[model samples]
Target: MVQNLTKRASPHNVNDRKEVLSGSCIEATASEIIQESNENMTVADAVAQMFENLGVKSAYGVSGGAMASLWGALSNSDIDVLNFRHEAGAAFAATEGYFASGNPTVVFTTAGPGITNALTGLFAARGEGAKVILLSACTSAPQRGRWAIQETSTDTLPSSGIFTTGTVFNYASTVESAAQLPQIFRKLAVGMSQPGGYVAHLTIPTAVQNMLMDETQLPEQGVSCSLVTADAQVVGNVAKLLRSGTFAIWLGFGARGAASEIRQLAEKTGAAVMCSPRGKGIFPENHPQFIGVTGLGGHGSVMTYMQEQAPVRTLVLGSRLSEPTSFWNQEMVPSEGFIHVDVDANVPGVAYPHAETIGIVSDVKAFVLQLLDILEAEEISESQLKASQPSSLPKPERSPVEAGSESLIRPEILMEAIQKVIVDGTDAVVMAECGNSFTWSTNLLRFSQANRYRVSTGVGAMGHAVTGVVGAAQARDGIAVAIVGDGAMLMNNEISTAVKYQIPAIWIVLNDARYNMCHQGMKMLGMTGADAIIPETNFEMIARGMGAKGIRVTKESEITAALETAIAANGPIIIDVLIDPDRPAPSKGRNKGLASQGVKSTSEQKPKVQASFPNI
Candidate 1:
């Protein structure tokens, strides 16, 4: 589907094609070739060509009149432009799509409300570390300060974070002329080539988008960059440090690509491995050395390991060890501080400022490879390290919950079925939405590989996974199941979008009829008079009304059959499980953190504790 202008030989478009030779045709750019072929090409077309060259395969957005030309250009290009229900949903989908596809995805919006609506999802993208570009339209220069319709001028909106390079956007620019196209494209290309997540913004005015571009003005088609790598001496020092004392591996989502090397490193050092919630699948969760996840619905075994058989120093891999992961827990700190390796140099010591940290700015995979080389060169075998390590590391507790004769299903039983039918049986990507859904899934399901389990611990947006599953399914070209609560399912579900695209995205809604996390969390903190209840909703009916399949599950025994059916369905499906409202999710740590932060708690009312199992 790559449209080559040089090869277009149709009679009607014959005038559009021309041959241009520059200095014996030795160094002519693709843009120059295109300029020679199509003299009447607009700025939109030029930008589209640049996106094609830059490896952007898809764009998600809600189309508007302002961006009509740009939309047309993208539609004509190889990039798949998906018209979503809402701008925020589109942005969320784009975020997940970027992660699933490993490509810089685009989220397009038109003026004012369109631009503002997508900000939350864009923030999520920035926090989760994904490459997403927001292509929007702004008020034309002549129309600025005037009473223009949906005027997206500086007078109307704050330009600091949205239109400038700062926390939100890695790069931002307004294309005022066709001449800026090349430089803009170059910046985008260069930015996308760098490590870690990059969220950018490019707003083109309506007038400029349709303006005829000159032959000399076209987007640049070439840009290249290299991955960050640690210095040889630094790698050697890290290896020596690891060899000198006991160290545990603390993983974050950033270390996802280094799973193989991480496994080797863990086995070689006989280190107990723990992960953040987002880092679920990066290391094999079922491995003997694996302790458990770290924060927010994290396992108690990790605390036990840190308390009882504390390592001399912890090897932090690509994680900031932020509040969500560690809650700044003092016990998790090692005796000799941490050797934190991350792509971002600033991430290491920022979370726990008091803790001594040796930060290495390099790709996790690259750093691990070099460290492995040093260990191998010194002939540091597993047998040598095993004697000093714990004879038995604590593993995550997995309590068995029977399918009791309760009218409403238990969340634990639901997760068990999902683990059996979807997580284990199929190759679907499982995502858990924020709230109790996040806690339940993080505490229950186990993944053995990277990219299989995804959760937004960064921003922890409510409706993210509910709508993002569509993008993941489409980008991955496979089944993507979203474990979401009824609140999220109702707030934002892309069943219609999935139906439009014929994507078989699935949602397992914990239909508890309330914001259960807020409900339970408030109760656990002993706060009163806060209403988190919602009128009971049937997500199955909503899904069916949206032209998708649906199944309602009211009892624990119905979960497996419902999940199996949904997984086998050819189109979008929803499984609405009416979960029990009284069961407390494994969120005691979060409640405890809230209590420490001056939240009120009653001494008489103790929160219901989840049952724990014996260590394996």
Candidate 2:
């Protein structure tokens, strides 16, 4: 039987659940609001207002004595604050919330160790081009230089260089002048809204937060500036290139707003489309001109086409073409000329040093619209546009399957199953774990306008998916799914958080019972030993211990049934599928490097082989 929670107990209570307030509630009347007008609100109140203005319905963070005031503010607001198991999980969930809804979200942490643990998500956000604000409470101002518990030098925070190229700023140290907060927050918002990315670290000292503010001194609401525009000459040059050369468009996370326009431009110009991992859902992968993802862990055909015969001009929009996309090698793009359109001018040519690149600082959608206008002014013939379409290249043969062997379920199959279930119409979000799971999901998932997918591409942090789902689900008010691996799931105990909040999330744990990727590396090093093997534990039992429903499956036929049952469950559910431990997913470019090492070992052991084959 389900117990109906009261509104007071669970302020976030939905589904007629009982409300249980962990603390006393403070009511605010019109007179109290007017009285507090001049003063800087408490850290908790300020945080609550910030999230409310950002359109965040819910937020996730770890709570402690340091952040109690902020927690009070969050609880007072309509936003539900989920207490996570780790600070990293809280930060990752905040990033995922932004990815899912395009709305700014908050991640709260206490000073010192909590802030340190949360930095990984900040780096991930910077790398993946996500806009996220991390709210952290610091030790009281009086505790400075006294070696107070959980104290650290506040000055050292900015020097971390996480937002080196992008915008990085700190909140005001004192709130005695409440008039400064709005402007400071506006600047932070503008920085985040800028094309590249931004990380605003707001630290509130305990002493300043406890002070009462005089009414009428409060700051005004914040405002953001428009995107910078490109020069006319640059637009003309881009138009000329688009008209003359066969081009392909490479998009990144920052290009989300111009997805439809990008697709239209591709269709109009007869160009092929590719995207970074963060840009997975920006382009419809099923479209004829879509060439799949490019970079490390990308499809082989897409890389071959980009390198060999596809196009002479590459238009990189909203993408920095960072390391893994360039295969950590500078010579990835052999094009004569490259055009990079980003909100930030500094992002281009940073990763690719020697390229002849043109940088345009403008909003991606507005710039593309202007370029389309320029193309129309040129009056290029329809025949000329038709001529830009290259003849279809022959599709490569599928990798050969070993005969008389068990039919192994590939990652593509898993993507297909989810795609079939959700279809293209639903507003669904997929949170994928790091490693090969990321590669497979990014490569195979067919992204639609309504569907969003998130991964920790920047920090490449493991165990991000499970916690990310909690935040994403809260933001969307829809069911969330996490596609994770057994290794990653163990690293972060996310089950506790899920049960505590009663968040109904579906976790698909691909259990292979080993550190498979590392094991593959060990095998390539002529070490056929299985020391890295992890014992198969009952993941379902683990979930049950945390007060959630759990399902275990060993055969392929059981996947669908388990998934259906898990999704229908009223609370959080974990489905642990026992995949084949021996069969690892094949990578395109990685095999050659391993094979070369294997060849050297074979040569060194040539004598043993001959001795064993003496009868032959």
Candidate 3:
């Protein structure tokens, strides 16, 4: 029963209600609302129950003095409480959880340094458009402004004033009273219902967390996850624009959920298809309609056609056309205007200028479904539709490794080997980290299903998959494979978390003995650099020491067998493959930026590598 919290709880202290709820240092509301409950429950129980109602399966973070009791409560619940080695790694795991489960996962942190440690992962989550719940505790009310142990300024509570910078989080607030719980959920409902990535920061003082409250007072469902469809007029206009032109389809990570409709649209219109690096698997890279990827690890087939041969208008789907996706090159933009469809209204026409821009604010799946219907209704002729197909374009080629070095395996060979296990053998989740990991996987790996291929390209954070794969593995039935560079693996301690849980995660570490992407870029630019050369460490030995299986692959022949062995193992396995550091870094078209600097190279000498390592 929803009892009035404004009412006093007992005869001895009947005036207690006035002291607590009547302008009593609590965050006030306009009117009286559900403020109290009949059952006795602690603040920790209320918060944990909120997560339960929100369908959270796992909560990741480290236990600290300020938030230990809350972590204790979560441990007794059905949701798994994973104590990560670091707050940032835990937050990254939560971000991956959102991607795998289609629901926001929770990340807990203590006050001060704990909250600050989580900022990088929070930034990556927002950049990737993932939904996550960040819970932290502040110093007790008496400790504020007194330089209490590990106390940060309570004037803002959770942040030092950074969550509001640019687009770090969708919503943030501090809970002052039990009466504000419902209102906080109400705000979360609004943020979750809106399209795009959302991070909600909710901080509670240590004292407020110990307060007694009623369990019935909190709503079971905190977020309104209703299906939002596209506008009929907007989808119809897009269908009309897409039908007649010699246009191509550009796939974004957002289009993964609408794969069937995307294929239907492409078939009906006979359009060419290219995907953003993060969008690889949505349209089936092996399909004839799919030409190549765009950006750092992208191919020249799509870009060359866009520049020299094709009279194409692009149907940009669910992409913001971020700098990496477009390479900030004006030539990639279609001569004719692009018909951009994204759920977020602010995402359209922000990256590249088009001749004409048609913006449609709607969900990717809904828009594709509506567009398919409109295409069938129009009944356009086959020849006209076929005209939209590419005219005798060369198919993408994968050059074989012929460096004749029996010592180090080529990156291409490694990607092909990993692809066999993920695509051919089992239905595993393949994640590519940024840098050469992103480039090799984008260029060499093949994905055909939704949510099968994952990456964080927007923030371009290194070591994302190193920790992010833990949650991804937990959410999936099969194994989660993380292809990471040695440089990225050295960044975090998520391997310990995976080992602790014995989760079926496989880490494919490309041991290049350095930050090969940067090292190669400097050499290619004819400049000397420092600290780019890192000593090769035995990652397999590290995993073994942490209680997980490990394998080291040297020759090309050992690649597939070692991966096979790792897959058949019981727990997390690290396959450290020594890749040829002498191989040119796979840049896709990122080296185009270096052309103006008078760095000329023949096809054989050009370094096909670009640096995309975002700050950790």
Model number with the top lDDT: 1
| Clash count in backbone of candidate 3 | 3
Return the candidate ranking by lDDT, descending.
1, 3, 2
- Give the per-residue lDDT of model 1 (tens digit) for 428-455: 8999999888889998999998989999
What's the candidate order when arranged by decreasing TM-score? 1, 3, 2
Residue-wise C-alpha lDDT for candidate 2, range 68-164, written one tens digit per residue? 7766667666666677889888877777777777677777787778888887767666665656777777767567768777875544445344322
Model-by-model lDDT, in order?
0.84, 0.65, 0.75
Query: Global CA lDDT of candidate 3, please?
Result: 0.75
Indicate the residue-level lDDT of 583 in model 2. Answer: 59
Question: Which residues of candidate 2, in runs, are more than 4 Å off?
Answer: 1-33, 36-43, 54-56, 153-183, 328-331, 393-413, 422-426, 525-531, 589-616
- Runs in model 1 with CA error above 4 Å? 1-36, 217-220, 588-616
- In model 3, how large is the Cα lDDT of residue 197? 78
TM per model?
0.92, 0.84, 0.88
